[model samples]
Structures are given as structure tokens and as C-alpha cells.
Target chain A: MITLSNLISRIPGGIAQGIIWGIMALGIYITFRVLKESDLTVDGSFATGGAAAVMMITSGISPWIAVICSFLIGILVGCVTGLIHTKMKIPAILSGILVQFGLYSVNLHIMGMVANVSCNPSKNNVFITMRSIPKAILVGIIFAAVLIAIMYWYFGTEQGCAIRATGNNERMAKAQGINVNNMKVIGFALGNGLVALAGALMAQYQGFSDVNMGRGAIVIGLAAIIIGEVLSEIIFPKGCQFFTRLIFVIIGGIVYYLIMIVVLWLRVDSNDLKLATAVIVMLSLAIPNLKKGE
Target chain B: MLRIENIKKTFNPRTINEKIALNGVDLVLNDGEFVTVIGSNGAGKSTLLNAIAGVWLVDEGKIFIDDVDVTKLPEDKRAKYIGRVFQDPMMGTAADMWIEENLALAHRRGLKRSLRQGISNSERETFKLLLKEFDLGLEDRLSTKVGLLSGGQRQALTLIMATLQRPKLLLLDEHTAALDPKTAAKVLDVTEKIVRKSQLTTFMVTHNMKDAIIHGDRLLMLNNGKIILDIKGEEKKKLTVESLLEKFEQASGEEFSNDAAILG
Candidate 1:
């Protein structure tokens, strides 16, 4: 029932949103793939970033400064989770949940006890807005490119290698004199910082920050990562380099949005989108295990 | 140079599962002395090694490396002077990492990891040479993931990694016990070569009685959470599997009954 023009019109907006989610997915990849942890902090930290950025911008702060502040706040949030998991000896998943539960109040306070904050692009010079979809897409692509570059460079360094090794094998890392707990803390901080950065940008792009914006952010991030990994395996059968894997993660996000657009065109109820996403992610996650059976 | 004075460790104390892992253990090792440790199941052999490696704080006692008291230090802090290889071949190396990357990690052991590039071009050359010495065709596969390696190759790589930074003390917790006989012998040969080459003060725990008698300058037998026998110098050189069994009976006042220890 959807015309070709309708589908074409949705591409730019979908791409823009996909790019933002791709950045969020990169954060998840750092924790899920690099650090080998299932961190639930992103769900809360994403909203925290949106709250921080919207509040700071509404108070006459530069958008760039607001983004940085959001990232720093996210790092603190991640540190709290890491400390709970490491010092308190709680399991990583439980620590993440505890921090996420606590962050709801913190996010509400940051938004001045409100569930939502709006940034009117007409009244203020916002960095990116849905009004100009093409510009938003360009800005999103640039951010993704810059972030992937920084991550690639950082992971090639010795401290970065230590983090990777700690994620791969904690016992071996400790034996090699690498402080595994410190590495975990650092990794969590960095991952959440990036997620917060994405949330900040996303608030500007969408013209509003809502506490519920991050409710299912973790699932979307995982979906992006899984899509990226599967796509990379199919496209690059020779295996990918570190940087290439990251590039594919962003590409995966874009593809995920495209798929969603197609599903929407088929007249699926918008309210059931989350259910569809969950099923997609579940199938993607089980693909490797299914292959092993063969 | 390592010393353990009156160390004690008890697991699940005051519970039905209470077990004494180490009971007032006392030991001293001169610099560069290779000591082989042997014991039956539940005899505190691995416990002694774990205590020395600072896996956890001893319930009571003092530990020192080169006269530097390290009793209160955590495992990572003590790692500066200690190198260890575990019984599981998969425990000593990160399976997802490339062989060179794993080596690079070991190369920086005890050194602060900074923003410097990992595995420089010159360092890669050194690693290639080192891998070539193993002659297992690993030099050609420096970028290969360690998970792809066989158990013996992993054990050999672990041995190399343990000695890369030349720790003050090396602990091998049944490092070769997981491999087949042929692979075990090859790995042991490499272990001896590296140990002698670096002159590392080493503590090796093994179930094989013959291996205990054949290697190391000194031998120790643990029984019931205590060292029941300690032998060294000319006396250790003359020991055989039968004599070690006899010595275990004499020291512990019980027959050597562990089948794995006897037959391995």
C-alpha cells in the first residue's frame, strides 16, 4: 500500500536515526564484545545524556559543551556501576541493574523533575534537527567516522591492548600483571561515555529528550552489533580488520533501519515495533549456535 | 629469593565443608633455585603455589619476595615478581588474541601499560625469533588466534609467556598435566630450557613422581596441608620414583596411595 515516493522519503530520516543508534551500538560493542560483559547501564545512561544535554543547552550552554558534559556524567555513571561490581563483589549484570535503577531518579532530577525536555530548533541554533534530514544525516555520518577512527587508534595502544586482553581472559591478564579491575572500570566508563554522547546528539536531532527514549536502548544496540557481525561475516568472508569490524557496525545500524522501514511499509502497528525488534535480535543471536549444530 | 613463614589458609571455615588448605606452611628458596613440589590429592601442593602467587590473603602469616614483605599485597600487585601457568592450557593465554598480542602482553608484565603502541615492528621481530625457537611453525602464524592452537602448543606458549619478562619467581601448577605423554615431554623439555636459560626461582607442582625426581635442584612433598619431606643437592640427584614413594611413606607415615601420582 506504500508508494515508491513514500519509501524514498523515509530513507534520509531512517539513515539519520540509524547513524545515531550506530554510535550507541559502538558503545555496546565495547562492553559486550571487547570487555565481554552484558552491561545494562546503557538503558539509563542514554537518557542521562539526553537529560544533561537538554538541560545544559536550555541554560544557554553551547551544544558542544553540553555533549561533553553528558559524556563526563556518563563516565561517572559507569564508574558507579563498575565500583559496585568490582569493590562490592556483585555480579556485573546485577551491578548494572542497580545502577540503572538508581539513574532513573538522577535523570529525572537532571531534567528538572520532568520526564521530557524539548529543544525548539526555531528558537535556538541546534546542531542537528529533523527539519533538515540531509544535514542531520551528514552530521551523523561524520560523528560515526570520527568515533570509529578514535576507537581504532586507542585500541591499538598498550593500555587498550590490556583492556582487550582482560576481556578475553581475566586470569591471564592478572597473571601478566595487568590490573583487571581497573581495566574493567576504564572500559565501562568509555563505553557509557560514547553512549551518552550519542544520546546527546540524538536529543538535538529529534528536538526532544524523554526519559522513555532509552527504555529499550540496550536491545537496539545489541541488535545493531549482531546485525553488523552477521553482515560482516557474510560480506567479508576473509575476516575483517579491527577498524573494518567497527565500520560494519555502523553499516549494520543503517541496515537495521532500512529493514524496519520495509516492515513499516507492510502496515505493521507502530506499537508492536519493539516486539518485532526483540524477535529480530533473538534470531540474530541464535544464528551462531544454530550454525554450530549444522 | 622467596620466603613463606607460618602461613595458614582455611576454606569454608566453621562450616560443614571446612577444609584446611595450608597449615602453618614455612618455606624459603634461595635465588634461582628450581624447586619441584609433589603430593597426592588434597595434600596442599597447589595451595602452596596459590599462596605464593597471592591468589588470596593467607589467614595468617608473612610472605616475602627478595626480603620485600608482600603478605598484604593483592594478586596483581604481587604479579610484578611472580609468573604463573595454570593446569588448564586455556587459562594461560587469551584464546581470542593473536599470538603476538599475547606475547606483547607478557612482554610488558610488571611494567605500566601506557598509550604507547603495542607490539612495535622491532618487538615483532623479536617475537618471531622467539616463536621460531619453539619450532612449532608458530613464527609463521604470529597473527593467528591462540585458540586455534593445540593443547601442547598453548602450554608451550604459556611457558614462553611466563618467562618473557623474567619474573623473580615462577609457579607452574601442573602446567603440563593436561597434555598427552609425547606433548608433555616436549613441553617439559621447553620448560627446563627456559627455566635454566633465565635462572628463574621456580616452584613446579606435578602429579608425576618420576618427573618430580628427574627435574629441579630440590624436591618437596606435601601431605595433610604440610610439607612432609624436603630434599636437595646431591641427595635429590640420586632419587628415583621408588625412592620418592619410600620417602613419602617415611615422612608422612602413610603409604603413597594416590594412583595418579604414582602412575603419572
Candidate 2:
């Protein structure tokens, strides 16, 4: 118990979890921070990604191909979110919740089971594939670095600036020849695509895809964003430049689990994990607004 | 260079709040022409610019730029031809990004955005030279976040961003209305210098009658949703606030009631 090797092993798991959820954090960052769209579909779309990856891999697809499929599925899910917002004329937040509720069952069907999809049978249903925890951590880090680099480059372009413009001042962005509608659609697609890729990697690493995995993801991502925002405000308060937003979000994700690790170290039970997470996010969100008021 | 024919827009269409913003308005701007629009509140001055910018679909109209029927084009697709500055200084550039980065973005308008680490050395030098023209000491501070600049500096930077591409049509929708009068005048001066130096076709909307008359070769007055008066040539040169008001009543058959527009 609490040996150096055991701590190292758990470090890999915690970091892997942080990186996988970084995708969701990036998704929340786009909706809440960037485009200012509150997308609750994040939870549903994230599970859908895992289910899609599992379904594809189970159907004789290569592991890498399943990853691609997972990303595309995420894009489709995002498009549905947009369709609900635009064509159906539904409120954005409501549309997200509706889609999430639908995906709860759909994810079960994708796994060809009502509970979980596993690479091997176990009583507790924990599966261990060749994608070991250490390898998963490496994959997560490399994937995050590449994705953030691409994000940095993309947001530096005109279209990227246009997307940001939509959030800063929608009317002005439209008047300056930026289509806010199309930009929102693109932003959603990109945001969820990252989330799905994370899910694919997660399913492979854990050797199982379960429906409940995505639960409370949005809150975690929001907490990370709020924490990241607070950090960036204190560290680089002038602004979180294009690349810096993504960088800080990644750091936010890492710091989030480190806080979780500390909570677990304090012997907090599993039942209160969600409660602790909620409090942390609430505090992060509140402190900034309170400071502004003061 | 720009033509708007029979354009009409209704806000909250098919509802109780359906307010007609532009009622079959028509206007033409020759190449390299500088035109100013002045109107009362709800006069559709901004609506006309918005229609051309493709912010939304017009209920009825044809918009042409350099003889191209641009009404069917999307906003970003039309970015190649149009440059716009807005009343809010934040509208024109990404505030968190550096001044050079914003300029680099403006410079790459209508081009494919690639992953090749934006802003080559040559472009950086070019941006510096362009920034120098603003004389706002921005050339030395290209690394500064745009949000740190004063409103006037931001507006000035915004003007440069709009004109950097030598756009076929430049639209200014009360670009300086949000600033103090002194800063507004400074920004207006920067606007004038840029517009003239580039020799681009430009349409500027302003609430101040004096600014409208003093800045452009032509001034058009709007009331309700129609153009009440169009002055150009020798007649436009002779306009004063009083005489312009007299013409508004003559053309529109009503007294101008926009106190802010009149007093401004």
C-alpha cells in the first residue's frame, strides 16, 4: 500500500484519465469559453464516441480505423446538435439534453449489450488489452500535443478568428462577413470530434466501453475550464492567446485530477466523488464573478 | 463599385415586431467613390450596410459589387471583396491576439488558412510598415494584446485591419459612435487617411451631420426606411446642418426627430 511503484502506476492512470477528459474539457471550452454555446450533448456525444469505436472495432475494423470512426461519429453527433438548434428551432441547452438522453440507450445497443462491452470476460468486467496503462498515457500525451498544435494553427487563421468573433460580438462578426451560423456548426463539430477521439483511446486503453463512463464529464470539463481560466487570469491575465487557451485547458485538466487524487488520499469515498467535483467547479466559477463584483 | 437595388428587410418577420428596415432602397457608388450616410434612428442606415455585408438575407433586393450579383453569397465568401469596421472597437480584431497576429489574419483574408505557422518574415515586415502608417506607435508594439490599447487605438487598428486587403467595398457602420468626441475625431481622421490612400470604394454611416458632409464627396439622408435625400457634386459641397435639415423635410415631408442625430 502506497509504495513508490504503486504510486507511479496510479500516476499513469490518473494522467490518462485527465488527458482523455481533456477532450471533453476542450469541448466545454469551445461551447462555454469560445463560441459561448452551452452544449449539454457533450455527455451523450462522449459515450456515443466510445460506443461507436467499440462497435466498429468489434465488427472487424482495425483499432486505428475505429478511432477514425469514433471521431466522425462525434462529428455526426455535433451536427445533430446543430440541426436541433437551427432546423428544429429548439433552445441550445434543451437540444443538448435531449440528444444526451437519446444516446444513453443508443450506447447500450452499440455495444450489443445493455451494460458494458469488454475485450475479455471477468466477474467485475474489467478488461486488460495490450494497450497498457503506460502506453495509454504516452498516447494521450502525444495526441494532446499534436491536437493542441493543430488547434493553435487553426485558430490563428481567418476562419478561426471569425469563429471567435462570433462569440465576442455576434452582430459585428456577421456584419464583417463572418457567418456566425456556419461558424457555430464548425465549432461544434470540431469540439465533439476531439471528445470522441479521446473516447476511442479510452475504450482501447481500458479494454472496455461502458455507458456510464461519460457521466458528469461536462461538469468536469467546466471545472477544468474555470480552473484554467482562473490560472490564466492570474498567470497570463492580459489574455489567453489562441494557442494559450488550449494549453491552459490541458493544464486545467491535469490539475483537476491532481485535486481529485488529493481528495481520494484524504480517504473520501467513491459516492462523494461527484459531490466533491461539483463543489470544486462551483467554487471556480463563483470566485471569479465574486472578485469582479468586489 | 457597389449597387443596392430594391432591397427590403423586415425584423422579426411574420410577427408583431415586424419592422421594415429597408423598403426597396436603391443606391450606386462609382469606383473609388467615398459616400457617407446620415439618418435618424431607425432610418435603416445600418440595415443597408448589413444587407450588403450578407449578415442576413434581405426580404427583397439585388446587391452587386463590381458587377457581381453578391446577394446569394455567404458572409465569409464575400470577405474577399468587403471590409467593415463597426461601432464597437472589439468587433474588428481578436483582442487576445497580438497586433501582428491580427494584422496577419487580416492580410490572409479570402486565402486558404493553412497550418504553416502563420506570418512569414516578409509579411511581418509588411505588417510593421502598415502599422507605422497609423502613427499610433503600434509598429513598436505589434506584440501587444489588442485589448490593452485605448478605444481610439483599437478603432485605428480596426481601420487598418479593414483596409489592409484593399477591399473592393469598405463599409463603416458608425465606427466611431462609441468613442469620446475627441477620440472619435482622431479615429475619423485615421479613417479618412486610410480610405483616401487606398482609393477604395467606401460607404460610411454616421449620426453626425457635420461628419457626414465634411468627410465624403456624397451624402445621403434616410428617413423611416427610404432614402429621403441624395446630395452629390456641387450641391453636396454646399451642405450645412441647417440646409440639410431643410432638404430632409422637402424630400421626406416630415421634420427630423432624432435629437442625437441632429445635435450630433
Candidate 3:
């Protein structure tokens, strides 16, 4: 029988995981919603960030510096995808796929040809750890809050407005003298950079990084975004500001994890978790269309 | 202030569907001139505007705006001097953006975009006043999305956007073609007021012969990628739909085949 103690013990861990995924969701929001471009590169870039962070920390680098480097490396990865899409004239989805495939090898190289790496929280000055779940949750929340503030400020700037316009209407953006191609590249770089930042934090929190850790990251990010949007519609019936919408995206991530905890608590087979995630995402996406029909 | 020299463009080159859109077309417009363009289907009117706007590089020849060679510039780079409204009302403004945001974007045309705030208090005031002048009650809806506006309102807003920064040349490619007759007429009225008030060098392509003659200081008829008739001044003012049809027949040695042009 599932007990109250079992549920209580899982809550902190769930909150930490949700906050980390919430950061990833914000990254996906930039590409999927703001740029209106499908980018699958996050799956590979997430692992790359984890590998970079773990390897750097193991090599005696500061954890904060290692995380920052992981973010920069992610931006470079995103730039490769952007160039493939914009300069090489490949479709956005195909370009992201190509980069994702290439980054699997690059990520392995970053981990010194290893598929996984682990850092001891005591040996390394790690940023966060599952040993202290409450501390990890607090750290994740702070990181998310800071990132959201930066993003809110960036999107209100002139350059950010240009990027928004490029996504909304390419023809109108070009007519307005906004370089649409450049905007796409900048967006990709920013999106992947944030995804990498989240990956770094996840690795530090879990005290391990693995190549397969980010296999279905894009789905999780989408789940967060869609859930956040749906919830925001209910919570703010009249309307809300852009910053509020972003905050909801983070909340969506938290809610996703809470649901996952509940499902696990129900004694569902752990091996079938991926299938459960897929069903949840599919339903979340279809609900809006289905509601419109009614 | 605008010149097109022997520009040529072909669609689906080397394929069975290959069609030459602009064939060695040449034209020039002095500063402050208002030129209306009329042509039948496949007459290269839209192609001419696209070439001048640098939608793509011309296969041959050069384009100049205000004596600056812009034939090699990409569309966004060429936007420094060119303002355009497309055949579709939806093509002009970002639908999801607020009305004031759209105006702010237009206000920054050809100017450098930085980390500065996208819209300032002063600029918002200016946009509010400009929307008030439209008399479409859009002034109160500055924060509303452009997608929620009516077709006529969108076109009028587009006209205002094209002239927000006083472009060196304005290219209107049947901007009101998609609107209903009444809405189209209202948009045309706004177009004329903006063009006349700014004396913007304009090239307007229209399917309506009456509109072609009723507005603008000069009118040109394009046929088979060539300018077959050019009328201006008192001659253009006195010209009617019948006389324009007669001129097309006289110049091209073919019947004026576009019923929309004649009936409109």
C-alpha cells in the first residue's frame, strides 16, 4: 500500500527535478513558440552540457565555471545547426537532426570517450546534490528565477523584438529591415545555451552524467510548455503579461514532475515510464485542438 | 529616385514550367513622382515590383534607389530605402504583435536595432496620435494584436507603416486586391492621402483601370514584360478606361483582354 510517508519523501526530489526541467522548457519555448522553429538539437546538447560539466569538474575546474563553459559549448553546437539550416539551405528539422547525430560523438569525446561520468559531491565542489534534496531544490529555483528574469528583459529589447517579428512573419521582418536569417541563428544559439545550462545543473544535482540522460528531453520540454500554457489559460482568465507566461512554463515543469511522482507511487512499471510520458505529451498537445472543436 | 535597367527574371528555369517573368524591363521614376501600374495577367507588373524590392537577384541588369546601386543587395539590406505593401493584407504586419509594437518596428526601419527598449514612451505617444488620425478607432486599441483588426484597418495601418519613416520609394503591389470593393476603396483613399501628403515616389500595380487613372500623377501599361504605354500630366488626368483600352490595343496590336481592369 502507498503510504503518506512514501509520498512525503518523494515531494522534495520531485520539486528539484521539476525545477531543472523547467529551465529546459524555457529554452524550448524560445525555439518552438517564439521562433516558431522545430529544433531537435536539445536532445544532444543536453548530454553535451552534462558531459562538459562533469569532465570539467573532474579536471579540477570550478563548478560554476564548468557550468558556464558547458553553456558556451552548447551555443556553439546551436550555431552549427543554425548555419546548416540558414546557410546550407537545409530545412530546420533536418538541420537539427544532423547536429543531434553529430553531437552524440562530440558529447562522448567531451566525456573522454566514456558513456557516463560521476562526481563525488564531497571530492568535488559540486553546485548541488541529491544528498541534500531541499538545498538542490532551492538552488534550482534560484537558477530558474534568474534565467527567467534575464529572458524577460531580453525579449523586451529592440533586438529581441526583431527576433519575435522574424518568427511571426518572415516577409514582414525582411521588409522592416530585420535580418531574418541572423535572427534565426541568434535564437538557436540562445535556446541551446539555456538547454545546456539546465543539463549542467541536472548533472550536478544527480551527481552523475550519462549519454542517454537526454534521449527524450525535447518531449519533456514540450510537455512543460503545453502544460504551462493550459494552466495559465485557467489561472489568468482575462490575460497575462509575457513574464507571467514564462513563469507558467516553469510551473508546468513542476507539475509534470508531480504527476510523474504520483504515477510511480501508483506502482506503475518503471520500464514503461517512457511510454507514459509519450501518452501524456500526446494528450496535452491534442487537448487544445479537441477543445476548439467542441 | 528609382530606376530599373534591363532587369530580367525567370521562374523554374530549365524546367518545362519555365516562364520568363521580367524580360529586359526598364523604367525610371523621378523623386516625388506617383506612378500607377496597370497590366493584364502575365504582364510582369508584380515581377517588376519584386525585382525592384530585391526579393531575389535579377538575372541581369541593375536597380537603383535614390541613385544608390542596390541591385546586388538582399531584400533586408535594400529595405533601407524601400517600403512595401504586398497584395495580401496579412503580409504587411506581424499578426501576433500589438498595434503599437508593429508601429515601433516600422519606425525603426533602416535604423540599427540595439539592446535598448523596443518601444519608448515618446514613440508610443506618437503611434497613438498616428492611429487616431486613421479614425478607425485603432488609437484606443494600441495593445491589441494586429490579427484581430479588419482587412481595411490592416491595409490602412500598413500604409501608415510604409510611410512611418518616409521611405525613399514605396512599392504597393495591389495592396487592396484582397479586400472587398468598399474596403478596397477605403484603403485606396488612405493610400492616396499618405502618398500625396508625403509625395513618396511610388509604384502602385493595380488590376482596376479606373483606380489606375483616378490616382497618381503618371500611369504605365505593361505587356509581355514591356512598358507599352506611358501617360502623364494633363493627358493622364483626361484619360478614361475606354481610352486606356484603346491605347493598349493601339500599342500592343491585341485586344485588351482583362475584364477586371476594364470593369473595375
Candidate 4:
């Protein structure tokens, strides 16, 4: 179990998992970090992406292409939330909830005739059973790498800095000639795109896309980001240095999955996993506030 | 270059806690004019600048920048025309970003922001030259985050940023009030240099009556809701604190009781 080859084999898998969660953490980072906007759209948009991917793939599109479509659709869902917040003057939190609820029905309807689109391993189109694991890992790495590069470059730009300034102080952003609304819209769109990419990748990795796949995903993603921030604060007391926060996001995801694995290892009773995950997320949320107050 | 005619604003309208912040306040600024405003704590000094900057929709009157109607323009929309520095240093620039990045945002005024990296080599050179003129040693620290800067340095940087785009009207609302006397004087000098060099139309509000009278070519005193005294030209040249105080009492018929305003 502890052999060199075995450890090497696990590296690819661990990296893939970390990157998969990185996508979701990235989505959370945009709303939480850049715009300082709390958004629940990730919960629904993630499922919306998975559902859309499954429906399209089953309807004869390649699974690979389906993933791209899901990402684009995720951006659209983010736009809807932005529209509601900007045009209706609805609070960001409420707008996210409204979108999440609406997407519940929308996600189910995307399944065509079934309640869920089960990926039959026997009837594989794009990937074989033996190659599926490596393929998923490869895809996850590529997606995470490309998206991470894009984010790194984007946030370094003037507009990207404006988005960050808006998060820091909207009034100051306006005083500097930055259109805060446009920055928020861009952040929203980018956040959802990453979430949908996560959803699409998840569908391919698990060989299924359920209507409720994205339930509580927002909290989980947030949990990863929070854990990462906590870890990072300890390592670098001066806060994020360049892409260190993104690294924490990846680390947070691995910590998240490892905790789940430990729970399973300890023989947690059936249906208790959800409760445990919720407790973990709640702790992550509360811990940062407590630290800040201290 | 900047004019306000009968501008009015009331906070919490039609309510028990209602307040008439600005009551038909009117003022004018000529091209390359430097004017300072002094008022009591709640004497509509800030409200006047806020109105000019389109911070809130006015209840009445009009604001014009070189004869363009801008009373209804939102705060962000007017950023191209007005550059404002606030009392709080943190309120002017993004502390999380590097000084150069914040400068880039200011330098890119009226330019479209895309996903590509901004701050070209030429712009960086320009920023270095500009910051060097401030003599704050900020030229070598372009990558340094603004949060690391002292309060004085931050305010100075904000001053440079406000004047970067050569705005039609530069609004300095107590830009140096938070600084110590020494740092405040230095910032005031930098401010004067920028305004003089840019030939910018400037409206600066200050609580220190002496600063108002000393730096700017003209000084206006505000009381309840209007300019109580406007002193400039030869009369301004010969004017002193005692004479200005005498004029305030003559115009308002009320003794200026603000000790901080007089003492400063």
C-alpha cells in the first residue's frame, strides 16, 4: 500500500481531485474575493452544468464537447443572477437563492425523460473503463491549468484590479472611474463559468450526472476556500502573495476529500456523510469570523 | 470650469430624521482657479463637494462642468470630469493592490478595460517619472502594495492619482485634514504644485481657516447654507485671520464659535 509506484500513481489522482475542486473553489473565490458578492448560483449552476452536459452527451454530442457547452451555460446562469441583482436592485444573497431554486426545476427538465442521466460504463462513447480514470485526470489537469492561467492573467489587468477595488470599496471604485456594475457582471460570469466546468468534469469523472448533484456544492466550495485561507494565513501571515490563495484553494479541496475519506474509513453510519459535511462547512464559516474578531 | 447654481440636497427626505444638508448652495470656479472652503462641522461643506461630484441626486438646481449639464450624472459617470480626494486615505485607492496597479487604474481613465494586462512599458515609465516628482521614493517601489504606505504617503499618492488624468475639476474635500501639521503642509504643497501645473479648476474644502486662506488664491467661508464671505484679489492679499473673522461676523451676524477652525 505504501510502495513507490503506488505513491506515484496516487500523485496524478490526488492532483486531479485537487484541480477538480479547484474549479469550484475558483468560482467561490470570484464572488467572495474579487467582487465581495455572496452568490448561491454555484449550487444551481453546477447542477445545471452537469444536467446540461448529461442531456447533450446522451443526445449524441461528444462528452468532451458537452463539457464546453456546460461551461458556457454556466456563464449565462451567472448573468441571470447579475441581471436580477442589478436591474431589480435585489440583494446579492437573495438573487442567488432565487436562481438556485429556479435552476432546481430547470436542471430536472434538462434530463429529458428521466430524473437523472446515468452514465453507463458498458455503453461508453468517449472513454473506456480502463482509460476513464486517466482521461478524467488528464482533463482535470488541463482544465485547471488553462483556467488558472486565464484567472492569473485576468486579475493582473486594469479591469481585473477594478473588480478587486470594487470588492474593497465600491465608492472608491466609482471615484476612480471604474464601472462597478460591469466589473460585478464580469466576475459573476467568470465565477459561474468555472463552476460549470467543475460540474461538467464531475459528470465525466463519476459516469453520471444527477439532478441533485450540485446540492450543497456552494458550501463545499466555500469550505475549501475557507480552509485554504486559514492554512495560508498561518503560512504567510501577510495574506495572499500572488496565486498563493489559488494554491490554498487546491489544498483546501484535498483536505476536504481527505476528511471525507477519513469519515468513510471510520465507518460513519449511512446517510451521515451529508450531516458531517454540513458540520465541516459550518465550522469553516465560523472559524474565519472568530479569527478575525480575535 | 465648474459651477453650481442653487444645488439642494436633503437627507432622509420626508421623515422625522430629515436633514437639509445643502439648501440651495451655489458657487463657481473659473479655469485654473484655486478656491478653498471653510465651514463648521455640518455647515454643508462636504455636501457641496458631494453635490458637485454627483454623489447624490440633487433635489433642485444644476451642476455644470464647462457648460455641460451633469447634475443627473451618477458618481462613477462623472469620474472623467471630477477627481476627488476624501478625508479618509483608504477611501481613495485600493489598498490590496500595488501602488503601480492602483496608479494604472487612475491612468486608464476613459480607456476601455479588457482582459489583457495593462500598464505598458511607456505607462510604467510615465508613472515612475510622475511618482519621482512627488519625491516620496515611490518610484523604486512600484510593486509595493499600497497598504504598506504611511497615511501621508497614501494621501500624496491619491493626490497624484486625482490629478493624473487632468480632470476638468479636482475636488479636494479635506484632503490633508487627517495628517499631522508637517505632513499636511507637505501634501498641501504637492497639491498646489499639481493644480498649478495642470491648470486644473479646483474646489478644495478645508476646516482649517488658515490653510484655506494661505494656499489658494481665493477663499470662501460657508455658514448655515451659503457662502458667507468671498475674499480674493487685493482684498484677499491684505486679508488676515482677524479681518476674515470680522468679515464672517459682519456677514453672518453670528460669532464663529468653532475653536478648531480658528485654532487650526
Off by more than 4 A, model 1: none
Residue pairs in clash, model 2: none
**Candidate 4: misplaced stretches above 4 Å?**
A1-15, A124-131, A230-241, A278-294
Query: Quick one: RMSD of model 1?
Result: 1.3
Candidate 1 lDDT tens digits, B1-264:
999999999999999999999998999999999999999898999999998888889999999999999999888888899889999999999999999999999999988999999789998999999989878789989999999999999999998998888899999999989999999999999989999988999999999988988999999999989999999999999999888888888888898768987888
Please report, in order, the local distance difference test score of every candidate based on alpha carbons: 0.91, 0.80, 0.92, 0.83
Of all true interface contacts, what fraction is found in model 4? 0.70
lDDT of 3 by residue, A1-294 (tens): 798899988988998999999999899999999999989999999998899999999889999999899899889888998999999999999999999988889888888888989988888989788889988988988998899999999988899999999999999999999999999999999999999989999999889899878899999999999989889999999878999999998999999999999989989987898898999899988887898996
Report the Cα lDDT for residue A72, model 2. Answer: 90
TM-score of chain B taken alone, every candidate: 0.98, 0.98, 0.98, 0.97
Count steric clashes of candidate 3.
0
lDDT value for candidate 2? 0.80
lDDT of 3 at B92: 95
TM-score for each model:
0.98, 0.87, 0.98, 0.93
Predicted candidate 2 versus true structure: per-residue lDDT over A1-294, tens digit per residue: 545565555665777777777756876787777788888888887888777877777666777777788889888888888778867889888988998889888888888766788643232222223346666667777877888887777766667776776766665454455566777887888878777777776676677788987888789889878777778889986665667778778778877877787667656797999998898788877886898997
lDDT of 2 by residue, B134-186 (tens): 78888889889888999889989888888888899999999999999999999
**After superposing the true interface residues, what Cα RMSD does each candidate give?**
0.7, 3.4, 0.6, 1.4
Model 1 chain A lowest lDDT segment of ten: A120-129
